[model samples]
Target: MAYVLWEFTILGFDPTSFMFSGALIAFSWLLVNNRMMDTEALGRDQLFYATHDPVILMDAAGRFAGANLAARDLFGDEIPEHGGSLRQLNKIGPMLDCLAATGELNPAESISVGDRVYDPRALPIASPIQRRNNLLGWTVSLVDITERERSAEALREALSRAEAANRAKSEFLAVVSHELRTPMTSLKGSLDLMFNGVAGDVSDRMKELLGIARRNSVRLQKLIDDILDLQKLDLNTLNFELQDVEPTEFLREVMRDCEMHAAQAKVRLSVVSDDAEGRMHVDPYRLKQVVGNVLSNAVKFSPEGGNIECSLGATGDALRMSIRDSGPGIPENAEDKVFGRFNQVDSSSTRASGGSGLGMHIAKILIERMGGAISYQSRLGVGSVFHIDIPLAGGVPRQSSPPCDSVPGDGEGVPAFGEVRG
Candidate 1:
């Protein structure tokens, strides 16, 4: 009977047996939690694998430690399960070259992998696990910039073609100018003889008609001369004699010379200088051309009896000169085009304005050559203002500054010349 009770007791659910069963259940729950954490970590790694940019980790001994999805996709099954293949390393040849040269590579570098050309970069990193040892190595990254490289190459090719075309056009213009000038010169001489009665005297009506013809011929000749001058400037053959010039005196002389033209247009032209006396370091003749072009435009654009203002001042180590005109102002949209060659505003004003359409372009080129800048502003139906800013030389005097003991004198000044040789 005692033995039978003992066997039954062992089979029954006692306190000790219940406690052991509860401990087992707790341990199982802990195991489930641990598995959940591990799954979450694996999911994060998988997410990194799907990115397009190739990522690779290598040890100090150049052994591949790990690779992302992109690296695997590129190498396929060829990449070893442990250390990467030499073929994989050689794939980014250009990237390696850039790294060798610059100690780092950027995404802008050109590279190739397999049959595909890739613009990629390789970045070197110190071993994270053991900095002084080969336990962990560096990480290399690559990005495909093939599209960017293609676009850049295409742009370079297009630029080359455009430059070739521009050179050809410039050559053609220069040849045409030379050919045209020879015949025009002959025509002008013939007209001069006829006008002077060298050929024969003519009746009153005939002479009047002949005078009109001569005037139109003169205007045509002027246009041709402007074209020739523009061509010379383009070809960089415009001979300039450089010298020191007094700004106040130079402005006065330019206004005086342009007085006749301004009077003919019935516009008042004047100069206002910040200093009564100051000198400039430049090619005086070329500077005169720049100023003359501005003055002529101002005079032509100003309404009759309206004010034409030319003001000069100092601006941040530069001499600033502005020519302002009171006329039907420039159209806002067409302002930029005005600086381009042969470009004029499409209006009655531009048509009525007699010019070879090279004045502003030539002026801009000349000013830029002199280490200066020219810009303009205009409002429709109001007025237009053109500003020139030129850097001052070391010896140049300011408004209230003292002058040097030595005053520069004109030596072999620019040759005497008339307007357009008409």
Candidate 2:
């Protein structure tokens, strides 16, 4: 029994047999895990092959590890089988260099890959290694951007055609305005001579009739001027003369000039200033023209015995000017079209308003030219307020006197005949 026990111990302690048994068990486990791994890898490879976009895997040194079937389609059989630089794939050298330098690339940037614009994306793959292992490599995705390129080219062509059409329209309007003004100038000159008694002495009733003709002629001249101004603004040819002017005084003067016209229309005009003294840097004439246009429109649209108020002040960094009128206010749905050329808010009211449907349009252009903006708010019956917003410099009013008036017609501040020519 002692001998049998010793032999059993020897069998149990056999080093060579124990080593062989352990090796066999490890080999079996490895075989099972390898089969499972191969199945997962095969599934990923099949999916990658079926994808339309080109996808590639690379090692840390920028050597290609693998590529999808879509890549094979783009590069044909010329693609290297294994361990080749992505730069060797085609004209992707610069893009590869950029990706390697920047560590990441956005998809919007275009890259050239073998005569085709490719939008490539580079994203890092996380490693299974612990403690935040160094970046092992990246997966690059390539999208054909040729369609985007074609669309952009088409848009550019459309823009060019639109610009050409606008130029043609502006040229036609400019020529017509010049031609119309020539004949109107001659007629106006003849009428002026007759009304001023240069032709002969006329009766009071005849004089009144001539005055009506002359006034209508002047109105026609104003329409032509507004049209020409619109053309200039459209063509970006309006010469800007910027200067510093006192804001309060400027508002006061604009109100003073329009006093007569407002009175004639039986509308009460008032001016409100937020500052006893304030100033701004802008083109004085154009600024006044913008204010005058707004005030005149307010007075014209207001009913008899209605109130028109002009207010000037500063709101934050912007200077604000508002003209409020009491009348049948703007139509709710027509507000957006009010600033468009030839868009009449109230078609039936235009004949009485005596406008060429260009006042607000011209005012908008003038204000924008001076680095300002104008907007309006109106209810159906309460009133309408036209607001002008201009960038402010914020300085004390200068001690300089106001500029002398260059030329004038009626106290309504319409330009004189010679002033209208230019």
Candidate 3:
């Protein structure tokens, strides 16, 4: 018993119907060709012919044997009753010849025939009359993929444009930060001098006005720095200087560094626990940035006369530093989003919101890059605690990353990177 060739269906066709029709087409081909087909065999042939795509049949020698009605309409006048080779078809002929040579009856690369693109599939069938007829023949279908290809190209173009725009924005922010920072620094310095009677004795009103100006300038400076740092993070240009640091001391220094901010907010800051004993292998400057970011959030949100507690504890080869704030706690299902840039939180009257939103996101990424994790726990009305955990390997260096252009600080307060001396 001779069966029809197995044809593969791709996009634009129902796979089940395609397989069912293909199975029937196998027996239909034998009956139709041998001139013994009934109405059922003719029905199967009609179903294959009615397929939306153009399809053709070729003998083992690459000669055109048959074609569906759709194929006849698509390749009009190119196919005759079966005398020409598949190589005679426009654009597809050479590809079909290559497929025949390699005996690859699978789907190959797409091709453009005339005005549209098509994904082509081939199916090879065995012949019993091998001596007189060809040893094998193929049933090939050309599925139109013009719309899909166009859509893919448009998506790629849009993504390229978006990436270009982001890069331009980063570049613009970098230039603005550099140009504005120097002048802003000088302006703040002048205000500080006037307030301190460097030029002349200042009156109380002048002193107060100068102090306000200094504060606003400081806020702007911080915003600019956050933007610049965020850009560096976007470009993966933020450097790290790994060092051995006592975890408990690190947390204590961060609390001290944040004391002024807490004082300004009228919130008392305290270290609740210092159970972490060993040193951690980490970039102290970057880690400080992370801790400072979380602590800053605590200070900003704490209620007047509220207490902000910092704690460091040991947890099975890892050190956990948590900052708790006595303020309106974060809402439920907000844990993941707290680190998101410009993330929306419970913005009621009790919560005092501040910061550029970039700091938290930058801190999260930086902490994770240093082989650490940042997370939080909160009660709706009680308070919230932000946790930072880093694995401790007993002072062993954990990174093979290239040396950063920064040197470690003397574990003082919240440390800043110093330039590496040549």
* The best candidate in terms of TM-score: 3
Instruction: State the lDDT at 127 in candidate 2.
Output: 73
What is each predicted model's overall lDDT from 0 to 1? Answer: 0.66, 0.74, 0.75
What local lDDT does model 2 show for residue 338?
A: 77
- TM-score, each model? 0.64, 0.70, 0.74
Identify the candidate with maximal lDDT: 3
Each candidate structure's count of clashing pairs: 0, 0, 1
Error of 3 at 280 (Å): 2.9
Error of 1 at 84 (Å): 7.0
lDDT of 1 at 177: 73
The better-scoring model by TM-score among 2 and 3 is 3
| Model 3 ranges off by over 4 Å | 1-47, 50-52, 60-62, 73-84, 87-91, 94-103, 124-136, 315-317, 344-353, 391-422
True-structure RMSD for candidate 2: 10.4
How far is each candidate from the true structure, as Cα RMSD in Å? 10.1, 10.4, 14.5
